[model samples]
Target: MVESLPQTRSVSAEAAAENRAWVSDLSSTGDRRELASRRLYDVLLRAARSEAGRRAARLRLAGPELDDIAHQAAADALLAICGKVETFRGDCKFTTWAYKFVIFDVGAKVNRHFWQRAGVAFDEEDWERLPARLGVGPEAHAESRDLMAAVRRAVDETLTAKQRTVFVALVLNGMPTDVLAEQLGATQNAIYKTMFDARRKLRTALIAAGYLQEHQPA
Candidate 1:
Protein backbone atom coordinates (compact mmCIF):
# COMPACT_ATOMS: atom_id res chain seq x y z
CA MET A 1 0.00 0.00 0.00
CA VAL A 2 2.91 2.31 0.62
CA GLU A 3 4.37 1.94 -2.89
CA SER A 4 5.10 -1.70 -2.08
CA LEU A 5 1.76 -3.02 -3.23
CA PRO A 6 3.17 -6.04 -5.03
CA GLN A 7 4.92 -7.41 -1.94
CA THR A 8 1.82 -6.83 0.19
CA ARG A 9 -0.56 -8.41 -2.32
CA SER A 10 1.74 -11.40 -2.91
CA VAL A 11 2.38 -12.04 0.77
CA SER A 12 1.91 -15.60 2.00
CA ALA A 13 -1.54 -16.81 3.03
CA GLU A 14 -0.41 -16.71 6.67
CA ALA A 15 0.49 -13.04 6.35
CA ALA A 16 -2.82 -12.36 4.63
CA ALA A 17 -4.58 -13.93 7.58
CA GLU A 18 -2.51 -11.78 9.91
CA ASN A 19 -3.53 -8.70 7.91
CA ARG A 20 -7.17 -9.64 8.42
CA ALA A 21 -6.53 -9.98 12.15
CA TRP A 22 -4.99 -6.53 12.23
CA VAL A 23 -8.18 -5.09 10.77
CA SER A 24 -10.44 -6.53 13.46
CA ASP A 25 -8.67 -4.51 16.17
CA LEU A 26 -8.39 -1.37 14.07
CA SER A 27 -12.06 -1.33 13.12
CA SER A 28 -13.42 -2.20 16.54
CA THR A 29 -14.58 1.36 17.27
CA GLY A 30 -15.15 4.70 15.49
CA ASP A 31 -12.64 6.61 17.67
CA ARG A 32 -10.15 3.93 16.62
CA ARG A 33 -6.73 5.58 17.11
CA GLU A 34 -7.69 7.15 20.45
CA LEU A 35 -9.17 3.95 21.84
CA ALA A 36 -6.31 1.90 20.46
CA SER A 37 -3.63 4.17 21.90
CA ARG A 38 -5.22 4.05 25.37
CA ARG A 39 -5.58 0.27 25.22
CA LEU A 40 -2.01 -0.18 24.00
CA TYR A 41 -0.50 1.92 26.83
CA ASP A 42 -2.58 0.05 29.44
CA VAL A 43 -1.47 -3.33 28.14
CA LEU A 44 2.15 -2.14 27.94
CA LEU A 45 1.98 -1.00 31.55
CA ARG A 46 0.86 -4.46 32.68
CA ALA A 47 3.61 -6.15 30.69
CA ALA A 48 6.25 -3.80 32.14
CA ARG A 49 4.98 -4.36 35.67
CA SER A 50 5.11 -8.12 35.13
CA GLU A 51 8.79 -7.96 34.09
CA ALA A 52 9.72 -5.56 36.90
CA GLY A 53 8.12 -7.81 39.54
CA ARG A 54 10.07 -10.84 38.29
CA ARG A 55 13.39 -8.98 38.64
CA ALA A 56 12.66 -7.04 41.88
CA ALA A 57 12.66 -10.13 44.14
CA ARG A 58 16.15 -11.15 43.07
CA LEU A 59 17.49 -7.58 43.08
CA ARG A 60 15.68 -6.68 46.33
CA LEU A 61 14.46 -3.29 45.14
CA ALA A 62 11.97 -1.48 47.38
CA GLY A 63 8.31 -1.20 46.36
CA PRO A 64 8.60 2.41 45.26
CA GLU A 65 11.61 1.66 43.06
CA LEU A 66 9.82 -1.28 41.40
CA ASP A 67 6.80 0.92 40.72
CA ASP A 68 9.04 3.62 39.27
CA ILE A 69 10.75 1.16 36.93
CA ALA A 70 7.42 -0.18 35.71
CA HIS A 71 6.09 3.30 35.07
CA GLN A 72 9.23 4.36 33.19
CA ALA A 73 9.18 1.19 31.10
CA ALA A 74 5.51 1.74 30.32
CA ALA A 75 6.19 5.34 29.31
CA ASP A 76 8.98 4.28 26.95
CA ALA A 77 6.96 1.38 25.55
CA LEU A 78 4.01 3.67 24.85
CA LEU A 79 6.19 5.90 22.68
CA ALA A 80 7.59 2.88 20.85
CA ILE A 81 4.13 1.44 20.21
CA CYS A 82 2.64 4.72 19.06
CA GLY A 83 5.56 5.48 16.77
CA LYS A 84 5.44 2.08 15.10
CA VAL A 85 1.69 1.47 15.01
CA GLU A 86 1.52 2.06 11.28
CA THR A 87 4.11 -0.62 10.62
CA PHE A 88 2.18 -3.46 12.30
CA ARG A 89 1.52 -6.29 9.84
CA GLY A 90 0.07 -8.67 12.39
CA ASP A 91 3.01 -11.13 12.06
CA CYS A 92 1.88 -11.91 15.60
CA LYS A 93 -0.93 -10.76 17.84
CA PHE A 94 -0.97 -7.02 18.65
CA THR A 95 -0.46 -7.82 22.31
CA THR A 96 2.51 -10.11 21.67
CA TRP A 97 4.35 -7.59 19.48
CA ALA A 98 3.57 -4.77 21.93
CA TYR A 99 4.76 -6.83 24.91
CA LYS A 100 8.24 -7.29 23.35
CA PHE A 101 9.15 -3.56 23.49
CA VAL A 102 7.96 -3.22 27.10
CA ILE A 103 10.07 -6.22 28.07
CA PHE A 104 13.10 -4.68 26.31
CA ASP A 105 12.68 -1.39 28.17
CA VAL A 106 12.15 -3.14 31.51
CA GLY A 107 15.14 -5.43 31.01
CA ALA A 108 17.48 -2.52 30.20
CA LYS A 109 16.30 -0.64 33.29
CA VAL A 110 16.81 -3.70 35.49
CA ASN A 111 20.34 -4.19 34.13
CA ARG A 112 21.11 -0.53 34.86
CA HIS A 113 19.68 -1.09 38.34
CA PHE A 114 22.64 -3.39 39.06
CA TRP A 115 25.18 -0.61 38.38
CA GLN A 116 23.25 1.97 40.42
CA ARG A 117 23.71 -0.10 43.57
CA ALA A 118 27.44 -0.80 43.21
CA GLY A 119 30.45 -0.29 40.98
CA VAL A 120 32.89 -2.93 39.77
CA ALA A 121 36.60 -1.97 39.70
CA PHE A 122 38.54 -3.12 36.66
CA ASP A 123 42.03 -2.15 37.80
CA GLU A 124 45.41 -3.80 38.45
CA GLU A 125 44.44 -4.44 42.10
CA ASP A 126 41.34 -6.33 40.94
CA TRP A 127 43.32 -8.26 38.30
CA GLU A 128 45.53 -9.63 41.11
CA ARG A 129 42.36 -11.16 42.58
CA LEU A 130 41.50 -12.90 39.28
CA PRO A 131 43.46 -16.05 40.30
CA ALA A 132 40.70 -16.85 42.81
CA ARG A 133 38.30 -17.73 40.00
CA LEU A 134 40.67 -20.56 38.93
CA GLY A 135 40.19 -23.17 41.64
CA VAL A 136 41.51 -26.02 43.84
CA GLY A 137 43.37 -29.14 42.63
CA PRO A 138 47.07 -28.93 43.23
CA GLU A 139 48.12 -30.06 39.73
CA ALA A 140 45.30 -28.32 37.85
CA HIS A 141 45.63 -25.46 40.36
CA ALA A 142 49.21 -24.91 39.28
CA GLU A 143 48.03 -24.71 35.64
CA SER A 144 45.24 -22.30 36.62
CA ARG A 145 47.64 -20.10 38.50
CA ASP A 146 49.94 -20.02 35.50
CA LEU A 147 47.04 -19.22 33.14
CA MET A 148 45.80 -16.45 35.43
CA ALA A 149 49.28 -15.00 35.56
CA ALA A 150 49.51 -15.03 31.78
CA VAL A 151 46.07 -13.48 31.51
CA ARG A 152 47.02 -10.75 33.95
CA ARG A 153 50.22 -9.93 32.11
CA ALA A 154 48.51 -10.04 28.69
CA VAL A 155 45.65 -7.80 29.82
CA ASP A 156 47.90 -5.28 31.52
CA GLU A 157 50.49 -5.14 28.78
CA THR A 158 48.53 -5.66 25.54
CA LEU A 159 45.21 -3.87 26.02
CA THR A 160 44.52 -0.14 26.14
CA ALA A 161 42.82 1.31 29.22
CA LYS A 162 39.33 1.47 27.65
CA GLN A 163 39.62 -2.07 26.30
CA ARG A 164 40.78 -3.32 29.68
CA THR A 165 37.78 -1.75 31.40
CA VAL A 166 35.34 -3.24 28.92
CA PHE A 167 37.02 -6.64 28.88
CA VAL A 168 37.48 -6.94 32.64
CA ALA A 169 34.04 -5.66 33.67
CA LEU A 170 32.35 -7.85 31.08
CA VAL A 171 34.42 -11.03 31.34
CA LEU A 172 35.65 -10.97 34.96
CA ASN A 173 32.99 -9.02 36.86
CA GLY A 174 30.19 -10.58 34.75
CA MET A 175 28.50 -7.27 34.04
CA PRO A 176 26.27 -7.26 30.97
CA THR A 177 27.22 -4.76 28.25
CA ASP A 178 23.90 -2.92 28.54
CA VAL A 179 24.41 -2.24 32.26
CA LEU A 180 27.98 -1.05 31.69
CA ALA A 181 26.94 1.27 28.87
CA GLU A 182 24.10 2.78 30.89
CA GLN A 183 26.42 3.37 33.83
CA LEU A 184 29.06 4.97 31.62
CA GLY A 185 26.53 7.01 29.58
CA ALA A 186 27.49 5.22 26.39
CA THR A 187 25.78 3.24 23.62
CA GLN A 188 25.19 -0.51 23.86
CA ASN A 189 26.50 -1.10 20.34
CA ALA A 190 29.76 0.75 21.05
CA ILE A 191 30.42 -1.19 24.27
CA TYR A 192 29.69 -4.53 22.59
CA LYS A 193 32.07 -3.73 19.73
CA THR A 194 34.79 -2.63 22.13
CA MET A 195 34.42 -5.87 24.06
CA PHE A 196 34.53 -7.87 20.83
CA ASP A 197 37.72 -6.17 19.72
CA ALA A 198 39.22 -6.62 23.20
CA ARG A 199 38.41 -10.34 23.09
CA ARG A 200 40.23 -10.66 19.77
CA LYS A 201 43.26 -8.97 21.29
CA LEU A 202 43.18 -11.23 24.35
CA ARG A 203 42.87 -14.38 22.24
CA THR A 204 45.81 -13.28 20.11
CA ALA A 205 47.85 -12.57 23.24
CA LEU A 206 47.01 -15.94 24.84
CA ILE A 207 47.87 -17.86 21.68
CA ALA A 208 51.18 -16.00 21.33
CA ALA A 209 52.03 -16.69 24.99
CA GLY A 210 51.26 -20.45 24.45
CA TYR A 211 48.37 -20.27 26.92
CA LEU A 212 45.82 -20.94 24.15
CA GLN A 213 45.95 -22.66 20.79
CA GLU A 214 46.06 -20.75 17.50
CA HIS A 215 43.10 -22.70 16.12
CA GLN A 216 40.36 -23.87 18.46
CA PRO A 217 37.84 -26.44 17.24
CA ALA A 218 34.13 -26.04 17.60
Candidate 2:
Protein backbone atom coordinates (compact mmCIF):
# COMPACT_ATOMS: atom_id res chain seq x y z
CA MET A 1 0.00 0.00 0.00
CA VAL A 2 1.11 3.57 -0.74
CA GLU A 3 1.68 5.90 2.27
CA SER A 4 0.13 9.38 2.36
CA LEU A 5 2.16 12.55 3.00
CA PRO A 6 1.86 14.15 6.44
CA GLN A 7 -0.38 17.22 6.76
CA THR A 8 1.33 20.59 7.42
CA ARG A 9 0.20 22.93 10.23
CA SER A 10 -1.54 26.23 9.37
CA VAL A 11 0.05 29.50 10.59
CA SER A 12 -1.13 29.92 14.18
CA ALA A 13 -1.40 33.25 16.07
CA GLU A 14 1.61 32.43 18.27
CA ALA A 15 3.67 31.38 15.27
CA ALA A 16 2.67 34.59 13.45
CA ALA A 17 3.75 36.66 16.45
CA GLU A 18 7.11 34.86 16.57
CA ASN A 19 7.59 35.50 12.83
CA ARG A 20 6.80 39.22 13.31
CA ALA A 21 9.39 39.42 16.10
CA TRP A 22 12.00 37.79 13.87
CA VAL A 23 11.18 40.17 10.98
CA SER A 24 11.30 43.19 13.28
CA ASP A 25 14.77 42.13 14.45
CA LEU A 26 15.85 41.80 10.81
CA SER A 27 14.51 45.29 10.00
CA SER A 28 15.98 46.89 13.15
CA THR A 29 17.89 49.59 11.26
CA GLY A 30 14.88 51.14 9.42
CA ASP A 31 15.07 48.68 6.52
CA ARG A 32 12.14 47.32 4.48
CA ARG A 33 12.03 43.92 6.11
CA GLU A 34 8.82 42.76 4.43
CA LEU A 35 10.04 43.51 0.92
CA ALA A 36 13.41 41.87 1.56
CA SER A 37 11.85 38.68 2.90
CA ARG A 38 9.43 38.53 -0.03
CA ARG A 39 12.20 39.07 -2.53
CA LEU A 40 14.37 36.35 -0.99
CA TYR A 41 11.49 33.87 -1.14
CA ASP A 42 10.86 34.78 -4.79
CA VAL A 43 14.52 34.31 -5.70
CA LEU A 44 14.68 30.93 -3.97
CA LEU A 45 11.57 29.72 -5.76
CA ARG A 46 12.79 30.95 -9.15
CA ALA A 47 16.07 29.08 -8.64
CA ALA A 48 14.16 25.83 -8.27
CA ARG A 49 15.44 22.77 -10.15
CA SER A 50 13.60 23.36 -13.44
CA GLU A 51 14.52 27.06 -13.74
CA ALA A 52 18.13 26.44 -12.76
CA GLY A 53 18.30 23.60 -15.28
CA ARG A 54 17.24 26.01 -18.03
CA ARG A 55 19.89 28.55 -16.99
CA ALA A 56 22.54 25.84 -16.80
CA ALA A 57 21.62 24.70 -20.28
CA ARG A 58 22.13 28.24 -21.59
CA LEU A 59 25.53 28.27 -19.87
CA ARG A 60 26.29 24.97 -21.68
CA LEU A 61 26.12 22.71 -18.62
CA ALA A 62 24.63 19.43 -19.75
CA GLY A 63 23.76 15.99 -18.36
CA PRO A 64 22.89 14.86 -14.81
CA GLU A 65 25.91 16.64 -13.28
CA LEU A 66 24.49 20.09 -14.00
CA ASP A 67 21.37 19.30 -11.98
CA ASP A 68 23.60 18.50 -9.02
CA ILE A 69 25.38 21.86 -9.36
CA ALA A 70 22.05 23.70 -9.54
CA HIS A 71 20.79 21.93 -6.44
CA GLN A 72 24.02 22.84 -4.62
CA ALA A 73 23.61 26.49 -5.64
CA ALA A 74 20.01 26.46 -4.39
CA ALA A 75 21.13 25.10 -1.03
CA ASP A 76 23.86 27.75 -0.85
CA ALA A 77 21.24 30.47 -1.50
CA LEU A 78 19.09 29.16 1.35
CA LEU A 79 22.09 29.09 3.70
CA ALA A 80 22.98 32.66 2.67
CA ILE A 81 19.42 33.78 3.48
CA CYS A 82 19.90 32.54 7.06
CA GLY A 83 23.51 33.69 7.51
CA LYS A 84 23.23 37.09 5.78
CA VAL A 85 19.88 38.11 7.24
CA GLU A 86 21.47 41.05 9.09
CA THR A 87 23.42 42.13 5.99
CA PHE A 88 20.32 42.52 3.81
CA ARG A 89 19.84 46.29 3.87
CA GLY A 90 17.30 46.20 0.98
CA ASP A 91 19.48 48.65 -1.03
CA CYS A 92 18.84 46.37 -4.02
CA LYS A 93 16.29 43.64 -4.59
CA PHE A 94 16.99 40.56 -2.45
CA THR A 95 16.73 38.42 -5.60
CA THR A 96 19.72 40.22 -7.14
CA TRP A 97 21.75 39.77 -3.92
CA ALA A 98 20.86 36.08 -3.65
CA TYR A 99 21.71 35.41 -7.31
CA LYS A 100 25.18 36.95 -6.96
CA PHE A 101 25.85 34.79 -3.92
CA VAL A 102 24.58 31.62 -5.62
CA ILE A 103 26.55 32.17 -8.84
CA PHE A 104 29.77 32.87 -6.96
CA ASP A 105 29.27 29.78 -4.79
CA VAL A 106 28.55 27.52 -7.76
CA GLY A 107 31.45 28.86 -9.82
CA ALA A 108 33.87 28.43 -6.91
CA LYS A 109 32.70 24.87 -6.34
CA VAL A 110 33.14 23.97 -10.03
CA ASN A 111 36.55 25.60 -10.24
CA ARG A 112 37.70 23.82 -7.08
CA HIS A 113 36.52 20.45 -8.34
CA PHE A 114 38.22 20.93 -11.73
CA TRP A 115 41.48 22.04 -10.14
CA GLN A 116 41.55 19.06 -7.80
CA ARG A 117 40.93 16.60 -10.62
CA ALA A 118 43.29 18.22 -13.15
CA GLY A 119 46.02 19.24 -10.68
CA VAL A 120 46.31 22.63 -12.35
CA ALA A 121 45.47 26.20 -11.44
CA PHE A 122 42.69 27.08 -13.91
CA ASP A 123 42.41 30.71 -12.77
CA GLU A 124 45.87 31.72 -14.02
CA GLU A 125 46.04 35.22 -15.51
CA ASP A 126 48.14 33.88 -18.41
CA TRP A 127 45.23 31.63 -19.46
CA GLU A 128 42.94 34.70 -19.70
CA ARG A 129 45.61 36.72 -21.53
CA LEU A 130 45.99 33.98 -24.22
CA PRO A 131 42.64 34.67 -25.91
CA ALA A 132 42.94 38.46 -25.78
CA ARG A 133 46.52 38.30 -27.05
CA LEU A 134 45.25 36.24 -30.00
CA GLY A 135 42.70 38.92 -31.02
CA VAL A 136 40.01 36.24 -31.24
CA GLY A 137 36.60 35.39 -29.80
CA PRO A 138 35.12 31.87 -29.41
CA GLU A 139 34.11 31.70 -33.09
CA ALA A 140 37.42 33.13 -34.26
CA HIS A 141 39.30 30.79 -31.91
CA ALA A 142 38.24 27.66 -33.85
CA GLU A 143 39.22 29.22 -37.15
CA SER A 144 42.52 30.40 -35.69
CA ARG A 145 43.32 26.91 -34.45
CA ASP A 146 42.65 25.44 -37.90
CA LEU A 147 44.78 28.10 -39.57
CA MET A 148 47.59 27.42 -37.06
CA ALA A 149 47.55 23.68 -37.81
CA ALA A 150 47.77 24.37 -41.57
CA VAL A 151 50.60 26.84 -40.99
CA ARG A 152 52.48 24.24 -38.93
CA ARG A 153 52.18 21.73 -41.81
CA ALA A 154 53.40 24.34 -44.27
CA VAL A 155 56.28 25.30 -41.97
CA ASP A 156 57.35 21.62 -41.68
CA GLU A 157 57.23 21.34 -45.45
CA THR A 158 59.32 24.46 -46.29
CA LEU A 159 60.41 26.95 -43.57
CA THR A 160 63.97 26.81 -42.04
CA ALA A 161 64.81 26.70 -38.27
CA LYS A 162 65.37 30.45 -37.82
CA GLN A 163 62.23 31.33 -39.81
CA ARG A 164 60.06 28.87 -37.85
CA THR A 165 61.45 30.08 -34.52
CA VAL A 166 60.75 33.71 -35.38
CA PHE A 167 57.27 32.88 -36.74
CA VAL A 168 56.29 30.84 -33.65
CA ALA A 169 57.67 33.38 -31.15
CA LEU A 170 56.01 36.42 -32.71
CA VAL A 171 52.74 34.87 -33.96
CA LEU A 172 51.92 31.81 -31.85
CA ASN A 173 53.58 32.98 -28.63
CA GLY A 174 52.02 36.45 -28.99
CA MET A 175 55.31 38.06 -27.91
CA PRO A 176 55.52 41.85 -28.07
CA THR A 177 57.95 43.52 -30.52
CA ASP A 178 60.44 44.44 -27.79
CA VAL A 179 60.36 40.94 -26.28
CA LEU A 180 60.83 39.30 -29.69
CA ALA A 181 63.87 41.57 -30.29
CA GLU A 182 65.38 40.55 -26.94
CA GLN A 183 64.92 36.85 -27.69
CA LEU A 184 66.31 37.07 -31.25
CA GLY A 185 69.24 39.36 -30.28
CA ALA A 186 67.96 41.94 -32.79
CA THR A 187 66.76 45.57 -32.60
CA GLN A 188 63.05 46.29 -32.04
CA ASN A 189 62.86 47.86 -35.52
CA ALA A 190 64.43 44.73 -37.07
CA ILE A 191 61.98 42.47 -35.20
CA TYR A 192 59.06 44.61 -36.43
CA LYS A 193 60.26 44.35 -40.04
CA THR A 194 60.76 40.58 -39.74
CA MET A 195 57.28 40.20 -38.22
CA PHE A 196 55.74 42.24 -41.06
CA ASP A 197 57.53 40.06 -43.66
CA ALA A 198 56.54 36.85 -41.85
CA ARG A 199 52.89 37.95 -41.73
CA ARG A 200 52.90 38.81 -45.46
CA LYS A 201 54.39 35.42 -46.35
CA LEU A 202 51.96 33.54 -44.06
CA ARG A 203 48.99 35.43 -45.52
CA THR A 204 50.08 34.51 -49.05
CA ALA A 205 50.59 30.86 -48.03
CA LEU A 206 47.21 30.75 -46.26
CA ILE A 207 45.49 32.26 -49.30
CA ALA A 208 47.06 29.56 -51.52
CA ALA A 209 45.95 26.91 -49.01
CA GLY A 210 42.32 28.18 -49.28
CA TYR A 211 42.34 29.27 -45.61
CA LEU A 212 41.96 32.97 -46.44
CA GLN A 213 40.14 35.11 -49.01
CA GLU A 214 40.59 38.78 -49.94
CA HIS A 215 37.72 41.08 -49.02
CA GLN A 216 36.95 44.59 -50.30
CA PRO A 217 36.66 47.36 -47.70
CA ALA A 218 33.16 48.66 -47.17
Candidate 1: residue 166 Cα off by (Å): 5.6
Tens digit of per-residue lDDT, candidate 1, span 129-217: 55443222243335765767787787789888788777666666567777788777889999988877877777777678766655631
Q: Pick the candidate with the highest lDDT.
A: 1
Which portions of model 2 miss their true places by more than 4 Å?
A: 1-42, 48-60, 113-131, 134-143, 146-218
Reference-based lDDT, each prediction: 0.68, 0.52
Tens digits of per-residue lDDT, candidate 2, 1-218, equal 11221222544455444444444544444456555555555566456554555544323455676667666766777667657655544444445556777765555444333322322222233334443343334543456656556655665555555565565555543445565565457898876776566555655666677665544100
| TM-score of candidate 1 against the unseen true structure | 0.52
The C-alpha RMSD in Å for every predicted model, in order, reads 8.2, 15.9
TM values, all candidates: 0.52, 0.36
Worst 10 residues of 2 by lDDT: 114-123
| Residue clash pairs of candidate 1 | none
- Backbone clash numbers for all candidates listed: 0, 0
